[model samples]
Target: MMDVGRHPNIKLLAYSEIESISGYIGNFHVRVRKKARYVDETQCTACGECAKVCPVAVPDEYQLGLSLRKAIYIPFAQAVPSAYLIDMKACLGTNPIACGKCAEKCDKKCINYDMQDEIIEFDAGVVIVATGMDVYDPTELEEYGYTRYENVITSMEFERLISAGGPSDGHFIRPSDKRRPKTVGFIQCVGSRSERRGKPYCSNICCMNTVKDTLLLKDHYPDVEAKVFYIDIRAFGKGFEDLFKRSKEAGVQYIRGIPGEIIEDPVTKNLKVMVEDTTTNRISEHELDMIVLSVGVTPRADMPEVQQLLTLSKTPDGFFMEAHPKLKPVDAPTSGVFFAGCAEAPKDVKDSVTQASAAASRAMTVLSAGKIKLEAITSVINPEICRFCTICAQACPYKAIKVEPKKKSIELIEAMCKGCGTCGAECRFGAIKMRHFTDEQTYAQIDAYLEEDPYNKIIVFACNWCSYAGADTCGGARLQYPPSARLIRTMCSGRVDEDWVLYAFRKGAPIVVVSGCHFVDCHYIDANRWTQKRVEKLWDKLEKLGIRPDRLFLEWISAAEGQRFAKTMIDIERHRQRVTKEEIEYTMKVLSEQK
Candidate 1:
């Protein structure tokens, strides 16, 4: 961090926020709002003269409120630029007449009460999101006694209490009395792996973090007793298992059970925990001087803003979704954006560092190439026929389409397009045509598939990423359902044009199924959502035309689900068998008339 701050080429914009983001890959225009620090960073030295005179004391958030800092202070010990910043909210100089002791005391005269926020604009080729994560606060968990008892603090507070620069000056102590505790209790997964109270995902670092803390305690004070309460210990990382073993060997007791409740003695300020040992099937109470709630990591508070600005997708856990879990773990579905650290998922320190390096390399490669490569599977807008209604623009998941209503113009950014063909499918008029998976090619595939005994065949429009791959997986697994199903592949389910479905039905097909990735897990971001809308519209149209809506089946199938693909095919076959030849002919005639 210090090296980056001093680097000639790197301009470190600390205490700044992204106000707005525009443009696309290799040509991005970004506006940043740099918050006022009230101190000239270039002139002010790291001397503690100004902080010593400031009267107002604020809770140090970096120390998890275990210590107090002056209103004018550096964020942390090794803060980049090594300058003190006045918190406007807490600083008395905000109302200049009240007080300005920091400005008066500064030997360099760098403090300025009239400092205003500055907005800066710049261009960048690629952006990497490494906003990191926030730790879950355990104050709501009354059973843990985090708020009621002073000694029942969080693991972060414990870290501050044990640190050399902490309030206790490297002496571990209870918050109530400021005296070192003989017995300490560590509770793992305080805000994780709980469907009711907290997040259902494992925190990924809590178990190992607790082990390290216990090891630290034993190394400093061997006589101090440390007991860890956890459902299970995950020591899967390199050298992590050895550290867990060392902690156990150092007399740290590991109990395979989550403590149900903590009761603190009002007079002594000691805590009593109730937990059931799953190994022995016994319930017992343990006494401790202090209890540390090992809180889980959660998505940053500003995650929503980041998601909106970057057009990024999020996972079920609320972290930014990667393009692919295995193949492109660090890359965002948005072409030029990448993710690092816990912004993508709850990763450990080493994993975060590794991802950061990979993101840098990816960004360098994109910049070095000077231009982004456009895939062949992008949508092309026919200006002559385009009504410029902006439906295509609205439906585009990547925001690749730009529509000008006044000028009656629509533009497509080829570099930004992910080839989902959502815009083409959403176009009411035949203005936007998807390359590779054109209307003509898709119609031909559907027509040919239903040419011979169409009533017996269930035509399936499967997405290339998920449903189509699922069929291949089914075949590889030797899973048999029925050969009556004929699959037609599109880049995305969103690429399945309504005309293609109408054409299939008019060709005398009994059942037509459209399948793709699940709504939230669309490989092309929200392309599958457009697919759902298109299918619903088709269903309504079919019903209005006196055709059975049930004849059109909509299913979401992932690539790994071979069994599900086979089951879905079997279900379609069963539905097809129920549709009599007379009903098929009637539906075919109705669709033909509608077309």
Candidate 2:
């Protein structure tokens, strides 16, 4: 942190928050709110004079509310800029009559309660999201007795208790009695891997953290007894198993079960832990001087706001979703943004460092290039034919389109567009045109595919990223399917215009199968959603036209689903075989008669 503060190229805006984010990938504009510290950072020498005179005291959040701090004090000992900041909320008031003891004591006279927050704006080429995670609160897990019993504390509190600069000054003591604990019990998964009250996903750091804590406790006081209650000791990291073995060698007891309940002895402030010993298949009760609930980590509370500002997407677990989990692990779906640390997932120190470095490299690559290379397959609009309806703008997932109602113009930002053809498909006035995939080209492919054996043929509309790749995977695996199916590839299932399906059916094709990436896993960030809706409309149109809606199949295929793709093709062939020649003729006649 000190290095970052001192770096000439780095401009660290400490105690500031992002207000809004705007513009494209290489040209991002940012607005920030620099909250008032009520102290001149350049003048304050971080001396103890002002803090000593301050009358107001509040629970120190840095110490997890285990200690008290004055209103005018540094956040921590090693804080950057080496300055004091007043907590306006904790201070008596900004008015002159309330309190001014700290200001009077300051030799540099940096304290100023009249100071106000400042807003700053800047521009950047790229951005990286490294908003770290917060630990889960154990208060909601009432069974753990976190708040009920003073002897029962969280692992974070335990950390502060053992730290050299902590309130207890490295003395590992129970909160109730302030005495060094002889028998300490650690409970694992307090707010992790439980569908009942906590997160269902595994909180990656809890197990190894407990292992290190046990070693620390046993090392500090050799005679002290440390017991760990857990579902499993996840010693999967490099040298982790060896460290786990060393902890056991140091006389740390490992119990394979989480305690069901904790009962506190009112007189002695000791805790009685009730748990079924899974290894022995018997219930047991253990008495402990102190209990530490190893809590899990969760996404920060402001994740949704961050997503809205950057136009980013998130996984179901609330972590930022990468563009592609395998190919672009650190890259955000937003063009110039990337992710690092626990903001992406619950990762350990080693993985977080690795991802942070990767994100830095990605940002550097774009910065060095000085220019963004847009793909050739981007969407364009014909201003003459456009209705300025803004449907294309509203339907765009990337927010790449701009609308000017007064000017009667719709502008497409080619650099921002991913060319999913969703806007083109949604444009009823035939104004939008995709670069590579156009209406004329798509019609040509359909006519060519159904030229021979039109009745016996199965016309399949496959997406370029997933379903087409799925077909290739099926063929690569040598999966046996009927040869009568002819596939027409589009950038996305959204690119498959409703007219294309009708045209294929009008050409006497027996069946049409439209497939794309799964809805949640769309390559173009939910472009396949429009595909699903368009298919539903086609189903209705077919039904109303005296045609079997079953003749049109909608399947969600992924790049990895080779077997499933093969099965879909085989099913479509079966349906094609069942379609009579008379039925095909009638369908062609009906489609041809429509407009």
Candidate 3:
């Protein structure tokens, strides 16, 4: 980030946050809230004279609470702009008139306590989101004794303690006693790969990081004993396995198991970890001078806020979702925005840098092009049919539908829309229609299929990308299934309007199946989630209308699941046969009457 900030082409704005993001690719308007620094960056020389005489002292966050810093100080040694910033929240001058000594001592007179936060706006062709990640606070896991024991530290704190510029000047000493430790224990997966407390996905860096730390410890003190407890060691990266072997050769004992509890001795403040070694089939306890929790990475707590701000989607793991994980790894569902670093998933420094560079390249691709070409599959609002209810805008997940209040109509932004057809499906007034799959075209297909034996046949609405492809694969594989099933392909399951489902039942179709990509695997990224919710609501409506909810089925059929697709069709056909013609006719009558 410091390197990016140093780039001459990049206008790095420090202490700024995105307030609002509006517009589409090749033309985005962004509003940033520039926080007050309280010091003039152009005049401040960064000399320590003002800080040396400053009276107010506070805990230095850069040192991880291991050292003290003046109220007016640089955030870190290599901070950009090299300007002193006043901690207004802690500064005495901001609260009371007790301190102005720093300002009095400054020869350049750069200090100013009256500066207010400023808002700035800019136009950008593209955006790269590299929000990074936050380490899980092991203090939440009380079993680890993190906050209770001074000797128990997080992996981040351990990094700083072992850093050359860190407090104690690169010396590895226990926080409680400030003495060199003879034995050290590292607990792996403190906040990772656990359903009970932390996340389920592997943090991808903890195993190698522990190895790095162990090597660093061995280099510093050859005689010091280092033991690591892990469920499994993941050495998948380039040269990572060699580093793991080096750590093992350096006398770092690798134990395969997670520690159940960490108890501390009151006398020496030593941490005692209890674990059952899966390798030796024996339970053991180890007392160490310091215990470092190899905590995992989690999506930022404010991730939802950012998602809402940028109108982005999140994966089940809470990280920002990419448009296509393989082909478009750095691109978000929103065209203009791209993802980088741990914002997409847990990654190491190398992976983060690589992804960050990829995101930069992807953003540059858009900026280099004067304009972006959009797909014609976007939805269009029919002003003549519109009721000005604004339901389409509310239903639009991408925020692509705009309600023109004065004109009393709705407008669709083609570039912004991903062609999910959620707006068209949610509009009760028939105001919205998706391109290539209009209301007339979709209903015409239903009419044509039902013209022969609509009452005896089953109507299936399948998403084009997944369920429809699955059906095609099932046919190509020669999987035997009921011939009565007729499939209609749409861009997404979200495009399957509730009215279409009811129309099938009204036309005397014995069964109606709505299928799409599996949850978390939607091509549109979470569009199937909306399909699931819609189907659940329709189930309640079916029950109220005296129709057996069993007649209406919703299944997730992936593109690769050919056998499952054929089996599902066979199962639905068999179930449909059980429903007598009288029952089917009765349900059809009820649906028609309701319509």
Candidate that scores best on TM-score: 1
Please report, in order, the local distance difference test score of every candidate based on alpha carbons. Answer: 0.91, 0.90, 0.87
**Location of the lowest summed lDDT over 10 successive residues in candidate 1:** 92-101
TM value for model 3: 0.95
Give per-residue CA lDDT, model 2, range 1-595, as digits (tens).
Answer: 9998999999999999999988878988999999999999999888889989899999998898999999888998899989999999888754755678898889888988889999999999899999998889988878777889998988889899999989888888888878888999999988899888878889899889999999998889989999999999888989999999999999999999898889888899899988888999988899999999999989999998998888787777778889999999999877889999999999999999999999999999999999989978989999999988898888787889999978997788887898899999999989999998999998888889888888878889899989999999999999987898888889989888888889999998899999998876787777888889999998999999999999999999998899999998887888888999999999999988994
- Evaluation by TM-score, superior candidate among 1 and 2: 1
Which regions of candidate 3 are displaced past 4 Å?
1-3, 473-480, 540-545, 590-595
Mark the 10 consecutive residues where model 2 has the least summed lDDT. Answer: 90-99
lDDT by residue (tens digit), candidate 1, 1-595: 9999989989999999999898889888899999999999999997989999899999998887778999999999999989999998898884655788888888899998888999999999899999999999898898887878999988888888899988788998898898889999999998899999889999999999999999999999999999999999999989999999999999999988988889889899999988899999999899999999999999998999999998998888899999998989889999889888999999899999999999999888888988777888899999999998999999888888889999987799999998999888888889998888898898888778877888899899999999999999999999997999999999999988888888888899899999999866799888888888889999998898888899999999999899999999998899899999998889877766666
TM-scores for the candidates: 0.98, 0.94, 0.95
The pairs that clash in candidate 2 are none
Query: Total backbone clashes of model 3?
Result: 0
